[model samples]
Structure formats: structure tokens, C-alpha cells
Target: MQLAAIREARAAKVAEARRILATAETEKRSLNPAEQSAFDKFKAEITSLEADEQRATFMEDCERRALGDPVGDRSFSAVQRQVNVVEVIRAQMEGRSLSGAAAEFAQETERRTGRKAQGVFVPLSAIESRAVNTTSTAPELVPTIHRADQYIEPFRNSLLARRLGVRVLSGLSGNLSIPKHGTGTTVGWVAENAALPTGDMSFDGVTLAPKHAGGITEQSRQLIMQSSPDIEQLVRDDLSFMLAQAIDSALIKGGGTNEPVGVLSTSGIQTASLATLSWQNVLAMLQKLDIVNASAANIVASTKAKAKLAGTLKAAGIAGYILEGGKVGDLPAYFSNQVAEKTGTPNTGRVIAGDWSQVMLGIWSEVDILVNPYAEGAYSKGNVLIRAMATVDAAVRHPEAFVVADDLAI
Candidate 1:
């Protein structure tokens, strides 16, 4: 059978197994002896079908290899070994306990890395085929449109804390306490019986708890079989981009219930009266920061506000402050979609300017991924679901070091 047909047959087998399991669980009780035995039998058949699909795919890859080479000189044994490596790598990803050939591969990997194979990413140096053609005819050199390899987030540059400095902490959850010097001690040339005043130092307590950020998606078995590597990469990038956007949103305007507290939303941060992006207001916003932080401070605004500011510079009466290389005066300006452009009824916008180094972001846990081959959502479609999760938080170390211009006219 063709590779696609084999994949479809395996998927049909999986669907059958799921149907049996579902029917047996309709009463929400433990399966009887006969039902248990039948379910086990179905599971064994599904396993056998999966193995058959793998073999069929390997054989097709070998055929492609033979057709691509002018001499048709590729050993079946070599192709089989490459296929085994790929399968072992996939088993490692699925968090299954490897045995047989897969177990030997894991052992060799551990010997080389000095750590368990499960914790490390074992790269597949060689695969059976690199170029895949769906047509039955002999292969030809054809240009292919590949997606952008390296993923870049739209809001990455505007994440102040992430750009300037971030405190990477380990653990599932924790609290941070930062010491504050409230008042200076009294300095005096004491007389015979004088007493000196005591210096006052206080600490601010911040609770850091990791809240789960995750998503799941399903794809048909045929789709997965068609372009496994490309589909895997696409799924991974999508998950990463989704998390990046989430973190950016929380850092800009989080409610503080479970996520990071945003600088604009946090109490007691300095605010400049910037009803509009006039040259005067812009200067005032820069001046609002302390001299020490002013040199290091940067501005983050929405794309809409940036356009408005560009127009403000061209206005006839206004003293245009030239924006050189995405900067206004000495401060570097950045734009993000996360910033609000139209907040209130009066059509207000927001502008954030600050020493971003004072902002701290805590990443609590590494991303965890799980694959469920028998998910109900994909059961009828004969597909599987991939889920990924992460945990993180953000905090401004010193609110005074940052400034926000809120309710500004757009």
C-alpha cells in the first residue's frame, strides 16, 4: 500500500479502538472481564497497525532515496537504521520508556552526554529522505516554499523587562523581598551626651506564583504523515509565539490576580500629563524620569501612537524633534501592539517610558509538552492532539524608575 493509504488504515484502526473504549465506558463504570479483554485486543491491533504504518513510511522514504540518486545506490539496511533512530527520537519525545533498539540508542546517547537521554534533545543526524515528492513519477529538482525558519515575535522588542534585564529563578513558585532605604541616618558631631538617630530600612514583599499558560491543537493522521518534520516545527513555533504574546500582554496590563502586575497598572509609579504627543509633552515625559535613569530610559508606544507622533513632528507650528533611527531625542522609541491605542470614551492612548532594567521577569518552569494520540476531539477525525504549557511572572523592581502617560489623546 502507498504511505498515505497505510497511514489512513492505521488511523482507522485507532478510531475503532477509541469507539470500543467509549462504548465500554458509556455507563461510567469499570469494564467487565469480556470488555477489558476486548479493549486489550483492540489496543494490540492498533499497536500492530502503527508499526505497519511506520514500516510502510520507511519503505517509501527508501524508494524516494533510490529515485533521487542517479545510480539508485542506497542500502535498505542503512535506511532502516535511520528510520529506527527517528522512531527512537520520537519515543523519547512522547515520554515513553524506551526498550530494545530504542533502549540501546538511549544508552549510547546517555554515555555521550553524561546525562539521561530523556532530559536532553537527541538530534537525528541522518534520515532516510530529505526531499519528499507526492507524485508517482521520478523526482526532479523543484523549488519549494519554506516558512521562515527562525520565529520572531511581533511584541518581542517592546518587552522592557525582557529586553533590559530579567531575573531567571528556578522552582514552581516563590516570593521576592526587596530591601528599601526609607531614610538616612543622622550624622552629627556629638557633644558629651548626645544620641544619634537610627537609619530606617524597609523591604517590599512580592509574591510570585506561576500560572499555567498553555494551548492544544489537533491534526489529522494523514496530514502528520505527509510532512511530519515541518508540521512538528510549525506546531512548536505556534506554541512559542502564543506564549510570547501572552507574556507581553501581562507585562503591559496584567490584572495582578494570577499574572504579572503591569507597570502602568501598578500603584505609585510616576505619571506624566501627556494628553497628546506634542513636542512639549514628549519632553515632559522624558523629564519625568530621574536624571540617573533618563539616559537609560526608553519609550514604548503603540503603532497607532507612533503614526500620530510622526504626524505631530510634521505639523507647521510645532518645533519638530527629529526621529533618528527609531528614536526621539536621546531616548530610543519602540512600538508594540500590546499597548492600548484607544482606551476610554475620549479616545485616549498610552505611552510608557522608563529604565527597563528595573523591571524583573521570572520564568518559573520550562515548557512541558504532551501528545495524546487518542484524544476525543480528534477521535472521529483520526488525528492526535499536542499540548504545551509554561509558567512565568513579571515585576517592576522600582516603580519610581518607570513612567506612564495614560489617558493621552490618540
Candidate 2:
């Protein structure tokens, strides 16, 4: 499957190269600077296709080994692993010869793929007093991109489900397929030559494709420039916090249209209807994890639900609060505003209980910063607009590991 995509992508580059040649042929002139650069890029990408094919082969080898299928050559580890993707990409965009670690990466990649390095370029922006942060997409006068080095966001705890030990896969690319095993081989007593039952584990898959998610920040020149010495950190913190909030919100209740499927929307997950945030309901939700065989678990609920549980009695005649000391049913409980207070009838909140480790978060890219230094309006007014983004997806390894209730009353 991945090979087909690679071939298609390679063919596209080849066609692009052909188109460049064909255009020059029709124009009856030598290739222009932009045309030549594009042609070279396409050529480089074509060579890299072979590496992608090898990568697919390596993945297929692992799958075959796991499924006990007939396996072939296992020599798919290329030297590209030593390369720093960000540095190489940045160097390529700057049109400068790579040095140090980047140069070594280029040689290794080119040698392994038998072609010069090239790829789909993603703009890497930096924090600085530059015109790139103008108000518009295109800058005012001169067209130039932005830059930054080792930019970092302010330190803070991420309230996302990841803190609950969810499995996080980072720096991934292309389409991914995660194999799921269900019900291993069964054993049954066989009586004196009687036929035995045949049973084997059923298999399924959780697929993750690249999806784009990002936000834009528009800043006045004065604020980014003269307002503070650490404007960069402030901007970064804002972007990081917003991005993290969006991801966390999606983890709880994404609709799966342009974003990833989340806990409430994942198919086959356990569900229950609760009209009140009571001890019985919380216990019922916890019991849903019986089949999960989890060593520990956690509960995430809406703020209102937390409030109600914190004030409600454990039982009809119980003395203590149902939720005491930030714990519910002896399990730690957390409340988030992202838990969707406007769900179901009466616009109630949501509550989830599960072995959080079964949650899988796939990150295709980190916080990608893009800046347009030349927006006419921003340049003239001394303003800048910053865009921060990341591509990610979420899935559940075992739907049964989670129980969700949207009927929780505040």
C-alpha cells in the first residue's frame, strides 16, 4: 500500500520534471532559474522514492514477522537515521551548502538513495524583530521568509491525556497502520482422538494518516518589538498553549471531520447513560475496565461533574463526598473545560474512565512556525502575524479499555 503511494508520488515528480523540460522545449529557450531549481528538486525527489520503497519493505518485513507470513530480505535500515530533519530542511531552504552534522546527513542520504537530497519543504520560522510578522500572508515590499534557532516554548504542565500515560508516537510521516490483536489461540480438552477446536487470534488495524491542524496569531509591531524583551517567549507560550488546548479538546470529543477521532467518537468503545454524577455511576464506569486488565486507571470529567461529585454524598446514607481529595472511587480524577459541557439533551457534560495507556497519540510534526515578513499592511504599520501548527492524530488500541458517558448531569 505504501509502495503504491510512493510510486504515485514519484511519478508525479517525474511528470513535473518532464513538464519543465517540455515547457522549455516549447518556449525554445534555456531553463529559467526557478524552472531549473524546480526541475532539480523533482529529480532529487524521484531518487528518494527508492528509499521510501525500502522503508515500506522494512515495515512489511516487521508485519510479516509478526503474522508468521513468509518473510524475505530484512536489510532496510538506511543511513538516513543519522540525519537531523530540521537542520537538513532548513539548510535546503536557505540554499546554502550543509556543514557539520547536516553535511554528513546529506552524504549518507544521497549515498543510500543514490540521489541528491530534496523534499517537500516546510517553512521553519524563528522569533526575531523581522518584517515577516506582518498582517498579511504576503509581505509589504520584498518577499522574504523568517528564521529562528532552537526556539522553545515556556515551561508548563500539559493537561492533555498524554499526562495519563497515553502512548505517544512522534516524528512520524506518511500513512501508518497499527495492527491490533484480539483473542489469542484457544485451548480445549480433546477426548480420545476426538477432533479439537481451531481457534486463533483475530486481527484488526488502526490507521493514522497525516492531518493538518494549526492556528494563526496576529501581533502589532509595537507589542512584538518594543513591548517586552521576551516577546518571543510570550508568543511561543500563547501558541503552544492554544495548540495544546485544541489537541486536548480533540482528544476528548473530536468529530473526526477534519480532525482525528477521539475517545467519545471512537467506534466500539463502551458507553453508558447517566443522569447524575453519583457514586453508582462512577463505579459503573470503572467496572467497564474489567476486561481491560489494567493495573491502574484514571477518570477525566467535566468541571461541573467534578463539582457535583465533590459536593454529593457517597450514597443515600453515606457520610463522605463521592469525590474526595481529587479522587473518585479511589482513582484520581481530573476535570477539564474541554470535556464538552454542551453534549446530549439538556446540554450536559461528559465523563470518561479508562486505562489511559490504551490511548494512542500520533504526532507527524512539532510546532511548525511560519511567518510572512512582507505583508504590506504589517510592514507599513510595524505589525506581524505568527502562525504555529502541528499535524497529529489519535486512536484507541482497545476500544473496550475506555468508557464514556455524555449523559452526565452537572
Candidate 3:
């Protein structure tokens, strides 16, 4: 009834051909003209139907998910979906099969270019929440009309780059390379009959590949078992926060190994040095981006940088603050606690401003989650270990489009 029918028909034809050969062998005779004709006909059908077996099967299975999800209103069908994060944690804690939607999504994920889920597959959509509160201690309940129970999203960073119109490439497979034209061919006027100037253009590529950024937390098995929305919300938020932070952090601070290269470490970007937080220093960062014809769009800054800019005046006893109403003058800005204060000799925090559109965020997989009930010390402690991983990579379409100021001080 499904894609299986097509494969089965091909298999049946092959089986019939094998039987024809077997009968001839049993009778100690070679194939006659009629037998050969029948065998060749069966072979032709199979050859026409053949393809990469796994990919063919997956393509046949692809279809819209018209059915409602068992958990919340979100559905994970052929199209990658945003999901209710809490139900995902519950499924792993309960030690059972995933919800209908998640299970089907997971099967689809394994079938193709979707993320490779090693455990309970939570679509990254689960954590791409609207709530931006970074505080983990508070639990806020918001009403919902679609589900039997209202859903609560996890607290997460005010993720900046994506909101600022950064390019997003999702559901990708294998290594990807984007070619960039570094220089254009030159044409110049010359004397008649003289040799013309020859110029060759240089090109470069922005390479993106799968990099695993993982976060882990230990949970009380008893607490998770209670199924209290509040308890689950907190646990789910913690897990979601882990995934969210990793992705956000990788965009600012490149994950050193086995992770994407972030703005701070990516070579060829504009850099500015500031002994202290000042309007001049901030403007200088943008100026570098400007010289390269890069549009100054949004800013991603550390919470410390936000505080300093908000509190410090352009000049002592001056009338205005550098930052107001979550903006640096006309430019919209975002802050993250992970943009840490440096402990180096100068002791500064990181601030990045750029044409955020040049930042390429490639997602190879969604949030892949696994809960281990038998983790060391888990059984004795009555807890389970929860680990979530996101397969992603970051590339700068034009490194010159970004500028970093990591030496800003209070």
C-alpha cells in the first residue's frame, strides 16, 4: 500500500527469474529461447526499477504529516518540525518509544539528510523557542489553545545572528563548500598593437561540515517520573538551554575542537582594540567593516558589555548612555552571558558588530538527545543522565563583513 509495494513488485520479478534458472538446472538442461526471453524480461523490469536502495526507500516514504501529534500541537512529518520540548524529555525518561510524531520524524531523519539521531530525536525546532529569558530558576506558564495542556517554552539566550537575518542552511548532508570570488579579472586600455594587461581573479571557499556540539545534565529520575508540568518544564528547559547555549556560543566563540568556527576566532574579520568602553571604540569597530563596504547591521555583545555600555556615559557627566532600550543608537543589539569577560592581562569582554547576513549557520541535524538511566552514580543517586547534541557549523560568507572587539573594558 505504501512504498513497499513498488519494491516488492521488483523483488517478485527477480524471484521469478531465479526460479526459472533453478528449474532448468534441476532438469539438467540449458535455457531454451522462450525461457531466455522470459528471464531477460524479468531482468529488464528490475534494472529499470533499481536505484540507491536506502535513498529510494526514503523517497517513497516521503509524504506530508496530515495526522495530529500525540504530544502538543506540533507535528514532525516529512518536513522537519518544531516540537514541544517537554514531551521529548518525558519520552526518554519513561523508557518507551517516542511519541508518534517524533518516532516518524526520527525514522525519516535516519533515512536521509535529516540529522542522525543516536537517541531520542528532539527536533531543533523544539528549542527554537520564542521566550528569551536566560534565567533558569524562574518558571513562567503561558496559556495555549491548541493542546490538552498549555505548553511552556524553555528559557534561552536572546539569540542574535539568526534574528538579524543571518543566512540559514538546514537539513544538509556531507561537507559543503561555498565559492567566493575574491578578485575580478582586470581590463585596461593599452597602446595600439601593444600587449594587453592580463589579470586573473582569485577565488576562495567557505567550507562547512558536521561538527558535534554536545551538552549534558544529570536529572533526578524520581522528579522526572512525577510528570508535573512545572518539574518537567524546569528539566526540559535545562536540557533545551544546553542545546541553545552551545549553538549560540559557537556563533560567538568558536567551539575549539569538533565544533564550528565562530566569529571571535574566524580569520580575516575586522578587529578593533579598545582599552576601555567608549563611543569611539564602538564606532571604530563599525568603521573597519565600513571600509570593506560591509553593511553594519546588528551587534552581539556580552552581558558585561551591555551593562558597561548602558551605564557609562559618552563623556564624564555627559547627558546620554551609549546603549538604551536594547539598542546602540539606531542599531538593534542582543546580549548573551556566554560572551564571557576575559581573564587575560587586559581583562575585557567580547563585542561583535557586523552585517549579520554574512554569517552562515548550517544545521546538519536537530537536537539529538539521549537519556542514560544507568549512568555511573545515577542508579545510586536516583537520577538519569541526559545528553543533547546539535550537529551544526558556522561560516563567514565574507569575513570582512564582521568586526570583533574583544578588548572592551568597563
Q: List the candidates' TM-scores in order.
A: 0.58, 0.61, 0.68
Candidate models: Cα lDDT each: 0.56, 0.62, 0.69
Let me know the TM-score candidate 1 reaches against the reference structure.
0.58
Q: Pick the candidate with the highest TM-score.
A: 3
Q: Give the per-residue lDDT digits (tens) of candidate 1, residues 1-410.
A: 75545554565455455545644554477777887787788788778877887788677556655656311244333432433332332454456765554344334334323433213222222221122112122336875443434333342334333554444443323444534445555566767787875656544565565665666656445534443565445444444454655666777777656777867777767888767556777776666664433323577777667776666663456666435568876667887777766556877667787766555566544444455677686877666665655566766666776778776666
lDDT of 3 at 406: 78
- Model 1 vs truth, CA RMSD: 24.6
What lDDT tens digits, residue by residue, belong to model 3 across residues 1-410?
33444554666576568667855764589999999999999898878666544555554434322333232233234335544455666687676776556676676566557445678666675565332112222346864333313445544456655666656776678898877788888899999999888889999888999888787777765556654555545555576567776676787777597768887778888888766777887777777865775666677788878888898787788788888888886678888776767778767887888766667788888778887878889868767787888888998777887888777774
Ranking by lDDT: 3, 2, 1
Q: Please report how far candidate 2 places residue 181 from its true position, in Å.
A: 0.8
Instruction: For candidate 2, write residues 49-127 as lDDT tens digits.
Output: 9789879977867775676532122322222233333343334334566565435433433332343322321211121
Off by over 4 Å in 3: 1-86, 89-95, 114-116, 128-163, 276-281, 311-318
Candidate 2 off by > 4 Å? 1-158, 226-230
Output the lDDT of residue 241, model 3.
67
1 or 2, which is superior by TM-score? 2
- Model 1 has an lDDT value of 0.56
Query: How many clashing pairs per prediction, in order?
Result: 0, 13, 0
